[model samples]
Target: MNYTLHQLHVFFKISQTQSITRAAEELHLTQPAVSIQLKNFQDQFEIPLTEVISRRIYLTDFGWEIARAAEKILTETHAINNRILAHKGLLYGRLTVSVVSTGKYVMPYFLSGFMRQHEGLELVMDVTNRQKVIASLAKNEVDFALVSILPQQLNVQQLDLMPNKLYLVGRRLDDSSLLSDDPGQLEKLPLIYRENGSGTRSIMETFITDHQLVVRKRLELTSNEAVKQALLAGLGYSVMPLIGIKNELLTNELQIIPIKGLPLQTSWMLIWHKDKQFSPVAQAYLSYLRANKEMIVQASFDWYQQF
Candidate 1:
């Protein structure tokens, strides 16, 4: 009936990620170590807590109950730790952030200044698809999420960060005909699309539908990086966020095709669950963002525009 807080913490991570390997990675432990600890934790209980089906881990009812309890315990423990830090006038703690895949390009600049100012803070950044990022926020797994599109289902408090300009990009080529701005020509171009559930994909879909752009031939890729690679190879044209292709655009490896009603603009937003309590560190970071948002966006776009 006795279990260490460490075991409970690991179990909570496993439940949150739904994967032993991912939990191990997040906890900075080896997979075998995580497995051993999990086994040891289970040995203390008479009933099974988890099961694996088709390579996916599922928590039993007992495991779900334990996980819920563990989450509350861990949350309270963190709150206590934050209170102690506050009393000491220390701005030191872990700050976890989940960002959409395209955010990988620009979030570092925003985080770097904050981390430098608060040297004692630990930053944990997870870059995933929009759906997973939203899930992390909803589960209270991360302190904040950076994304272009906000979820309609979640009650979240959000700060608008910057404009996320999406452009029609392709390999730089000599044929000027490929850069036509005519919307009717869209039907003839080979369009590369992001996978379903991607925020970028959703935006692109809306743009296509709104403009009535018929994409006769499209190749669906899983990531912005993949779509960029496909474009570089002259495989197809893709509507990609400017942040993701800034380097390529600067180097002239890729060119934004001049198209009518182009460069679809969406705002990047920093969001958190409205009811979730923020730690001191999270609060400080949020304040820092509010105070420096203009400079941050300007700096990012300045860099992007330089080339």
Candidate 2:
């Protein structure tokens, strides 16, 4: 009735491993400490929970019963936590999130609005590539992710927020001296592309293959800035997300290449694991995303539709 959660977790770990030393290693505690806790539990219950023969620990009948009961208790405790956190206007918890670098422009504005609504929440954001985002989501390292596409293996619950269109960008639209204005002229111009495992890169590849377009490989870069610099410097033209080049488009630092079927259409999805339970902060943030969905779509997403 009065056992600590740590003690219950340790009990489960020890029972599963069937080795106190292994359990201690898993829990980052000393062997003697684990042994003492087990002994304390046995004394408190007035029953022998463990029997050691030939230096191997085996759970006795009572030990098995307590371990099973501990699992149920832990499960109920987690359910209670979820229910309590679900109450309105009670958003206080840690929310770890990951997003592609291209989404930085759109995600921050939406997240800022959510933070204002839930002032008590703590936020941790990781700007990583698409592969890392998927890996982190499946490992439960991040509570949620805003990504172009979720991995197939993950049991992801996705909300399609808005579509992102890919654009062929260059230094200026007037500088048609480099590549032809015709759509099939993509084969002649040098192409700047993102590194492998990038969501934008994957989308680009699919679009190119589908449209039967070929490009002369000019340069490869990691960041969008690098890609922009390369285009501005007239090294090569590149396909990039419209969101990433809003400022460049406004300042006339970069221009979209005039070609039919140039901007391939793809949507950004707000995704999280289907099996995992969301905390108060994460749920609140999701609600905020859905509520202001139009504003987010209009902010940085309108550029693609304009073309």
Per-candidate TM-scores read 0.73, 0.67
Q: Kindly report which residue pairs in candidate 1 clash with one another.
A: none
Error of 2 at 251 (Å): 1.7
| Model 1 vs. true fold: TM | 0.73
Over 1-307, each residue of candidate 1 has an lDDT whose tens digit, in order, gives 8888899999999999999999999999999999988998999988899999999989999999989999999989878876776788879789999999989987898898999887667799999998999999989999999999889989999999888888888876466775578876677788998888998889878888888877865699889999998998999888899888877887899988877887888888999999989888899899999999899878766775542
Task: Give model 2's TM-score versus the native structure.
Answer: 0.67
**Model 1 bad stretches (over 4 Å):** 1-88, 173-177, 305-307
Whole-model Cα lDDT of every candidate shown, in order = 0.87, 0.80
lDDT for model 2 comes to 0.80
Q: Which 10-residue window in model 2 sums to the lowest lDDT?
A: 172-181
Count clashes in each candidate, considering only residues at least 3 apart in sequence or on different chains: 0, 0
Query: Candidate 2: which pairs clash?
Result: none
lDDT of 2 by residue, 96-169 (tens): 88888787866776677777766656688888788888999989999888898668888889878887778888
